[model samples]
Target chain A: MATVAAPGTQAYARPALLDWLTTVDHKKLGILYLYFTMFFFAVGGILALLVRTQLAVADSSFVSNNAYNQIFTMHASAMLFLFIIPVWAGFGNYLVPLQIGAADMAFPRINALSFWLLPPAGILMFAGFLVEGGSANAGWTAYSPLAQQSGSGMDLWIISVIILGVSSTIGAANFMVTMFRMRAPGMTMFRMPIFCWTMLVTAVLQLLATPVLAAALTMLFIDRNFGGAFFDPNTGGNAILWQNIFWFYSHPAVYIMILPGMGIISEIIPVFSRKPLFGYKAFVFATMAIGGLGFSVWAHHMFTTGAVLLPFFSFMTFLIGVPTGVKIFNWLGTMWRGSITFTTPMLFGIGFVSMFLIGGINGMFSAVVPIDFAIHDTYFVVAHIHYVLFGGSVMAVFGGFYYWFPKIWGRKLNETLGKWHFGLMLIGFNLAFFPMHLLGLDGMPRRIATYSESGWEALNFASTVGSFLIGVSMIPFLIAVVAAFMRPKDQPDDPWEANTLEWGTTSPPPVYNFDELPEVRSERPLFDRRHPDLAGGGH
Target chain B: MAAIESSPRHEEGMSNGMLGFILFLASEVMFFGGLFAAYFIARADAQEWPPVNLLTEEQIAAGVQLEMHVGLPAIATAILITSSIVIQWAEFQIKKGNQAGLIWGLFITLAMGVIFLAMQMYDYAQLDFGAGDTIYGTTFYTLTGFHGAHVFGGAVFILIVLLRALGGQFSAQRHEAVRACSIYWHFVDVVWIALFTILYIVPE
Candidate 1:
């Protein structure tokens, strides 16, 4: 084993462009995903601000209705496809191998292919905005008949989504193979990190779910371009077919977005509390349950469509909360009565729990079939989604970045700036979205370009102001990252004294993760190796 | 305890390549499953079979439309199914260190694959209607087009394996490439059988 070259010795050779293109090194691929997702995030955020600006005034036009439609469409398309999904993949790519003590992902070239496919997909989606009619105006759901309406942009949207679906399928296959085949010896399934377990389930969902989306899009494309009548209500085809296909994929897709964030919380809580995760087995079961239950609840999105059967889907939708509730209790249990440190990651984790609980409760309200009919296409639904996605997923994503920054960059981020960022973001997020619930109940419908004589002006103004504050909050976060890069390195190998295998290695781990892979006796092998007494004790 | 170093035997762990192939096939199953579900849903609501009938007036008048075009597709399916067997034979030969047998078996498989593709294209061209003419034509073409693409991909795999065989890359022990190629060929064959049964054998 010692005869193998030292970690950096293999890094001596300058690699070619083709080598970089084909290289399966998880770290390089992870960085690529990170940088690419950041670009998309910025693009998607700008689109959001543009949409908010349009909504700021009542019947005071900054942009045409068509332009407003394009803005919001691009915003949803960019955020969901390019920003959220790839951001999680970026974190998973970099950290999964490190946590599991594998040298690289199982199928490295396939990994590279997956990352490379995203840029073209993003280009295709944005290209829709450049066309004559502008991007798809029909909401991200892209319901049929609206989606089937011939426009220069609709075909481009279809093509881009299909390409992105292919990329996701390939990536999902790689993750599954890696987790199953490439773990270090003694790293049994139960002993793997919570993040790894979450990723495994997420990949399974992606594998099963994404292809259905691709099929739906393909059918739409055919209906539009080839004169096929798959979704044409005038023909024998049913319009509700599109909704069924879209939500079947989209609901599991919600899990795809949140499950990894849940994993990030699971990791952060156990570390900060200085205890083994309370009810580790229960948490694992909850993750699996979330993935399993995700499929049956998709019809909840169609409650207002009135096309689907109600009681069965509503039951499934409400049942999902049980497993999700179990997760929240497990997290609080982990954080109870321990030597807790309030790191930036922990702050974000706690924020995720609090905000996501509100999001979940609001979701439960929507699950009531009659209530969903009331608020179905209103701003309440909009606010609830943002709370779940932004408050839950985006916050957890930030937590992961802060927690894993030292391992990836070998430099500690400035905690002062992070705290400031977190505080402002939390305030801005609630202020922006919380009032949306009231505005929605007050009878201001969603997807409308303007409102007239409704007394919605005050709430809309408040929401707009909050949106800008959320934008401002990003400044401190970006500045902290810049500061971390600019400062002279001052990070130790294990800055957090973490429990995972990743922290056992050097800061910014060697090209190949470990010189000799350690045999795992428990989930927290590094902690056990370093502190035997703590391993045996509850705390 | 002695610290053993640099053991070549460590490389003998269960093959990653084979495991990767199985996982890839699993994903493919989900992909095809989605398409099949679409077909099932579409068929369920289908009020009259073949919504826009494509049979020529003479054939419809004479009732020849009900007659099966079994001979051509059966030949094609036979060629594809037989190619799978021959590809496996090639893999077995390569594993046994029989270079001549491996080359001949691979050559035969490739020839049979090309014949199957040609027959498939002929069958597609001979369709009485275009894809946009009717719903039956649309579903038929889309499903079969996707199947053809898979066959084309399988052909490329076989061609690459044949080229590698020519270059003397495989031996008795290290033959994962051959095994993976054989598995892919078999998968394509299985897909063709399903397509044949659904599109041809099942009465409209």
Candidate 2:
């Protein structure tokens, strides 16, 4: 037999650094995603800490108003665009192909281009802080008139968002083609895993929603820089026009964040509970219903602005809770009767459920027209958003990382350190965000650099302490991840006794994914193969 | 390795290039849908558009900006629409392995595409209007300017396919590049038809 290069050596036939830079392999791209997203996570987290520290004391001049404005603006911008979205894309990049039993994405070069655009987009957004006037201070929403007055920083923000939008659009298209065209034989659409289904829906939403935002931002750029009257009221332009266009995209964008997290919980709850997913068809329908209804309720965000028809939007907004409630029950049903395993991933999944419930309830309150008028610009709104975005989406993302680490790296992360990390994060996250409810109810306005000296100080101080704890919690998690990587050993292919097709192949799967595509007989083919008797049994 | 052997390469069921073009057209529809929405809303609020009664002699001496921008574009639109027919005929001929008919049809279509681009640029240059002139002028330029950019892209695609056909690079079974270019050319033609109706034919 002719001598053959080692697997890793064969994977890298050229210079190592260039191979990584230009690599199209899904596993390597996944690692790149993990590294890039973690970097932004750290940066966005620091910004969160700074924002919390400034809020810790009442009417104290730790940072100026403008500085505080920049901090909050950059923090939201970084977390939403830089952190959460990329993290989901990263997870999809790493897992979707393996799970679906495909060799690679249909458009591998486009996938590489899509990922490369993200870092530059992040840098352009952050570069606003270094500029003369400072970062865009119109908050993450960047509403018109206020956004229009924001000088060059707003222009930079527009440019950055458009770039990020292009990246998401390309990635979404690549995902659609791959999912539709590249599935292995017998991997019919319904037989695919729920995670892949969620991804397919998320890709559709991204492709549909992103272009509208690009149009809105392009119009805004024209109004600001080129004296066009698109959103300029004084020039016969309507300010409410921006609201229509912004929410048209922003409403579906919320689903773009949560659907993947919902997919994660769907994947985890069934595995840890050692049962088939409850109401599988209902779960699929619920996800699609959420995505469809997501587009119609965008006007709900404009309840206070009164530009939208309130009763219609309010009813539609509250109607969303039905499908969302179905998913929560599905998870609960999944865990009802089984030998439940409480891995670190499971703990975070549980954290997501509890936190997302609170978020959903608070979101419902905002759907009431009068209640929104009361708390529209208050810290109550801030608390509700973070509960959903941070507590819901971020928690599930971390759980996904924990669940998939062994498959990606060929080794399991140290469980002791993982538990430590989870414990600290759970406690710290609650301490950080839970007090904001009380503070918001007590009449502390959000986005304020300073506040009156009164009852708010103590809770603000508690929130700051919690934020620091959250920051400190990352150490053990990082260490656990590093330790897992450094221990050069291969895990059993199915380390977690997982049910998906991804676990059917070797850990740290070969560059082209499976050597021979497994025949997909059911949604959980691997589980069926591992336990034939339990294959058709109900929970 | 043998277990992972490749499947017999039949004709691709749906060519990659064709799928890409179709997807591109779907996105283009959404993009223009936004502009059309804006236009309808703006028009609905106004009692009249272009305020034709308010058109002063001096403004008309603004050299009938509409005529300057759209007169030649209309001719280009006719050329593009006819070229779509020729390109479709070429695709039909390609399937029959009628090399002479295929080459003749492709050459004519490519020539029409070039003439269309040249005429659009001439229209842009002759118009005295800039972006900041008025809402009428602004919307007019933005809509037409974007359509012009799409035309330029289609022309480049047509040129690439023409060069490849000349080199005999496409077989009857493997001519996805030609099929994709035809679909794209048709889409560009469809967009121009809409643009011509809204921007030029309809009373603004």
Candidate 3:
């Protein structure tokens, strides 16, 4: 056999560093998004550790109250803005074009601009801590009046968040154009990959919801800086208006964060189970149904505020569960009685389903107005948020990482290391967040620097242990990634026998995605290519 | 890989740039929708616009009363709406392959845009309120101020299109930029009509 250059060897014309910084190629841009968001993930993770340390014991003095506030605020902000939201963009940027058989994103320069906007926005947001009165301490929601209570850092938070919103909005537009206009010859709307469908829905949500958020942020900025009274009740402005507007965007943002993760899990389950996605059409409709229903449920977040229509929002909140349930059953059906492989990616895929169920059930509980009144601002709500966001989104993020790592880098991650990473993260995630359920049930309020309740300390301590364990879990994942990179880029075109068009191309697909795409007769084009005898028959 | 070659590799749809630009406009609509929502909420919550009772005499002395003077804004609205037509005329001219008409149409649209902006600034100067005065003033200025910013953005977009038109870079079939600019101008005009009715014509 002819000798091949190593995977990381200089294969392109420009020097690697400048090539990356200036390149508008979707794959390179996607890589940049991954590296950037992952770095923020580590930063956000460390901040979370600081938060856990602060709340570990009764009246814990691990950090000062102000510092604790900033840490937790930054933790949420970094995770939500810097990590979770953009990480999906990272995946979509890399995979959507390849999966749809496009050359690059529709607006590649704007694609690069979208990624470039994040660093400065992140810097401006985090730079708040160095300024006077510390960073925004009003929580990530940055509710009005309290949001205005902070210093210039809050200003930075507002401006940076607006910038980030602009970035997401533009990115959403780019994705919509790419998916709508760039599908290959036989890839009909219904025939596209499930992940692309999810991105389509997610992009629609981002396009519509994020701008409302930018408007809300603008109002808050004016209120804070220009003596405006949008949320200041003393001057005839209503605080509930802020809640109304904030949740209007944020409620859909919940889907913006989770749907792509669901998409990733959708891709993972099918590949590992050796089955077509059960109810592929139903799954796509469920995703769109979730997107449409997402807008109506914002008031569910404000049920305790006493200003919203109670029964209407409560009913809508419960109603959203119907489509969500459809998705869960569909995922299970895909894996039912199939040739299931418990690869690391599949483990995380299964992890997402199980954990997101608990999250969904708890969320539904909050939809009950009476139940929400009790746990509105408590650790129970915190637990639910983390379960949905961390357990749901973060798990799928890892699953996507492992599933696509080979395709991206042309080398499989070490399987033993992968299992170790998955196992530790599973244990550590449950250990850390599961106790928050009890702590919340035990009357533990959220966002407090410390707790003084008699019986809450043990669970709190357990949570701290779990959080650090989760932190420790990342060590193996990083090692797996690094170790994977150390090997040669020698993966075949179809490493996992996957079913998407992305697998039809070379591992670490060339600057252009495909040389010649296989004739797409079904959603699982690669599967059809590999098993022509099984074509048009159920596997 | 060099730049992706422009070819009909995928099935036919709107050009990628036009589709992307339209999506951008969709987001812009939502952005304005948010401000309008805030405006309506503020209006619904308030007992009165320009609450003279809430104003101190000293504040009244500081030029913070609510003399809306809808006449100027109405005139500006007409001007902006007409500019949308003028820009559409430019697109029509380009579509029919009339280069000179395209140039003249774009120039008139650009001039109308500048005049509308100047008229708006004039209106802002003549107003007897500031954004910090009350929720009414805050909502008023915030809504109109953001609209004005969009107007400025539209003008800049027109300027770019005009410059391209001057450079003979557009034709009947090659005027995607001109068409995108026209669509954006129409969107701005529609938003202005909504803003004018709510801010001026409505009996709040």
The 0-to-1 C-alpha lDDT of every candidate, in the order given, reads 0.83, 0.81, 0.89
Q: How well does each candidate superpose onto the true structure, as a TM-score?
A: 0.93, 0.93, 0.96
B162-201, model 3: which lDDT tens digit per residue?
8988999986757889988899889988988998999899
Clash pairs (backbone) in predicted model 3: none
- Residue B9 lDDT in candidate 3: 38
Kept native contacts, fraction for each prediction: 0.34, 0.23, 0.76
What order do candidates take by DockQ, descending? 3, 1, 2
Determine the backbone clash count of candidate 2.
0
- Candidate 1 structure quality by residue, lDDT tens digits, A27-71: 989988998998998898888888788888788588898888778
Tell me the spans in candidate 2 whose CA falls farther than 4 Å from its real position: A1-12, A536-539, B1-12, B51-70, B126-128
Off by over 4 Å in 3: A1-12, A537-539, B1-13, B61-63
Task: Point to the candidate with the largest lDDT.
Answer: 3
Alpha-carbon runs more than 4 Å astray in model 1? A1-11, A15-23, A516-519, A536-539, B1-14, B53-71
User: What does candidate 3's lDDT look like per residue over A449-485, in tens digits?
Assistant: 8877689888989999999988888888989888888
User: What is the CAPRI rating of model 3's predicted complex?
Assistant: medium
Listed in order, the DockQ scores are 0.35, 0.34, 0.72
Chain B TM-score of predicted candidate 2 relative to the true chain B = 0.80
Q: What are the TM values for chain B, all candidates? A: 0.84, 0.80, 0.91
